[model samples]
Target: MTQAVTVRRDGDTFQARLFWWHAARLLDPGSPIIRVGFENGPKSFDDIWVEYDPKRSAQDQYGAPLRREHVQCKWHVSPDTYGYSHLIDPEFINANTRSLLQRARDAQLAYAPDGIGVRFKLLTNWRLDRADPLRQMIGTRSGAIRLERLYGSATDNSKAGAVRKAWRDHLGLDEEELRVLARTLAFGEATDTLDGLRDNLDVLFAYVGLRRIPRNESAFPYDDVVFQWMAQDRLEFDRKSFPAICDRDGLLGQGEGRRHVYGVKSFEHPIDRLEERCHQVLDLIPAFDERYIRSEADWGDALYPALRAFLLSAARDQSKLRLALDAHATLAFAAGSVLNIKSGRHVELEQRTTGERIWAADDFPPDVNWASLEAEVVELDPQRPDLAIAVSLTHDIAPDVRRYLSATVPTVGRLLMLTPSTGPGAQSVACGRHAFELAEAATRMVREARGSSPVAAVHLFVAAPNGFTFFLGQRQPVLGPVRLYEFDFEGGRDRSYTPSLTLPISTRTGDPV
Candidate 1:
């Protein structure tokens, strides 16, 4: 009995953490989730409830908008695996009177009679049985059973058909009724451990401007707070009330003024919940799909004009802009130039390579060790008017830049290579301050190298973090007319560097300077 009590307590903590995760998103004005509830929905799947605004509802794998999600969290002290057969077992689902399938059907009927916009989810720490036929039917990306697989092929003699027959017989339903229930049901494996859930919550807490759990602290204040709330029967929260509760609990962090998020996506997997996080989104995937530009004209005609217009409008709002870039390095630099240092906008870059960190110019003190640059100059043609600058902080891209310049741009007379003193690698740049100092040093190097010569334009190529590239662009005015270049990382388009946006965009005419 004592062991059972302890097990229940641990399980409650896990459920509380999951509740806090969805609940905290209510602080974001742009979040689609308008309300979150704990232990307040259908009794069987009532661990948590997340209600989305119908106008901005999140879509499922099949692209159907979801209005609400009823989640049931099952946590265990030891590793366990379950298969299709176990789902119908009363002991496995812990059903007193009705099985999980029956509860899910009832919940759908109550919430969404037509089954247009509701989901019943079972989130468990237990793994799916590796050898089970159920594993083959589940969609790897969706975590939901495939509709065709659930219905099975024509004969109904396949393994998936057998599992479907078992479930249908257990539920006492016809094929159509079974399809409706299965469509609304999703079974997902929770990958996070107890501590891992806390870590994820810390990230969300920071984003919503809430106090984070202090490092190395033995006591978990968040878990304690959830327990307190549970005792008081304060289980429901919405956009307005959630922040009030957080403040009353002393969970609010130092207030930063109005934050406006912007997303620049050029990839297939866009930023998740971008509409929830950003006030505006600039999608460049149409012009530059994945890694390669579809056409040479697309950069100047479509991508740059759209990006510049977006930044110009955002800067006029006079709010701190938080930029999340899932784009190529060149476009990242171009974005920086649009919202240049003179724009007087406090911009924060979301850096996510090693781990998630918000990098801002003033986040840390200047590191003197990171102030200097290792410079190498190569004179290709002294008579030519153009000079190429290769900044390699992430990796050595000088070789690739040189090859591209030699084959394509004969007008580029010289090439300048700039790297960190410690040499180039992923961890070369430490933080935002370090990146800012490096950008300053790089700008000064370009000025000294040009030295009263008739340098027509500076061709810029950078292999660095998106944050660093933005910082570099902020300092572009110090260098003369600068042209940015993008490389085909995916090798779909010639496997070479192509010129992108030319910086120092004219303010009066909105043209390249």
Candidate 2:
């Protein structure tokens, strides 16, 4: 729950914005939501209402009856001085209870249609500070001491309880009636402040379009995409405008396909296909830091054009790079592309064994190729027998576990154990380069045994960074389906290993297959 940070408190635009945010989630595609009235308009009820049908006009005499709702938006900021006594402050009581009752009454009389349902909703950004004794008095417990005192069952009342009395007098309701009204009042509270909300909005934004580099607050210099959308008028809190955007984008429920799938469930491999249909959004951090963030007045101008160009370039390469490869192919592609990007020219790719041409110097290359250029090609077996490649880039496996795997899994086929080369006095660290190297070595082994026999299977026993795992996926169109394993380490020692999900390797990526 985030209070909208982009607006001011005095003007109370946040209430409207809050309404906009909620309405977007509620309204169905093409549901008729009419702006019944604004603040202080005569013959109007609260904020807005949804008509039973959009096909029939509200003005039509024989049209369908309008099914509507009453929504009241309220914004409350905590008092500067903290005290239990502030809970009874006339201002707080007046804003929340008395005024709300009057509004609800007026709206009911003006708009409640016969035999049609009406929902009363109160949306607010209040904590209802628990320090207030008044809040405690409204506890859900039926036999509570606080409820008894408020209802006069317990008869000791001072000036502190007068706020409840005022509310009762204004609404002309008894204790039980007030309790029922309280239950009917749909209260939505935002516990999170604006800043925290903004951070979450960033993650949500990633699903829609952009991908940003992961970094600490100090390292992240640009304004967030949500804030930018707010500033540019792309995001609004109006009754008609908000729903229209949701309908256009198909964010109706769990979202339309990729907007919800890859964006929401990136952890799970796709069930129906090898990959998602969505394009990989450009990583904007590098360009923003290099060209705009610190440069005062010209930042926007510089950023906009640079972003446009980068997006265009990515779009150009998308079709060619859409194909997914196994660790081997991903390595060669990455090695060649990384070298090409660094040199500002294409790199020649050659087969290790025959020195046969693979990619010419002018050929377009993928990003992970830099490490592949320097990697050695290892032959698996001359007879080209079945093989199992166990890639461990993170750390050394326990001797006992290794021996078990050797005996349990058939050794008639070669077992190529791939690990990062450790340097003197330096602890082994897994990274993109190391991941690519392992894949490159595995690629050579696979190539040598291609026609002789099936790959048997490639099993990954990995303890690596998320970035490394992600890159490993990027390089896949492996010779066969790859299986990932999870190892449990208990008491700082290896305990057991369990098979995880199988990787969905796409051969040529047009759609997710």
Q: What would the per-residue lDDT of candidate 1 be over residues 1-513, giving only the tens digit for each residue?
A: 988988897898888888887887888777788999888789678989889999887665466888888898898888999988877877887777677777787898898777668888888889888778887666544466668776667646988788878988998988888787777877778766687677667767777888887759967788778768878898888988889988998989854433667888765221133555567788676564336677877776778778888877877776578888877787788788888888878898877545456789889987666636888889999999999999999889999999999899989998999998888988898888788778888988998889889899899988888889988888777786898888866444587888777766555565332
lDDT of each: 0.78, 0.37
Model 2 Cα lDDT, one tens digit per residue, 1-513: 244452343214443333332333223232244333234321213443333333422211112233443445544554322223432343543454435555554554454422124434444455444555454443221111233435543322653356455656676766655544433233334433444333433333343332333536543222332244445656333446654554554433332222211111111111111122223322222221211123322222443333234433543443233221212222223222222222233222221111111223233334442332122223434454445444544455534335545555443245555555441111232233444444455556555545455665665555443323444443446445555554544211245554443444222334221
Q: Would you estimate the TM-scores of all the predictions? A: 0.64, 0.31
Model 1, CA-based lDDT: 0.78
Kindly provide the TM-score of model 1 when superposed on the true structure, using C-alpha atoms.
0.64
Candidate 2, residue 394: CA error in Å? 29
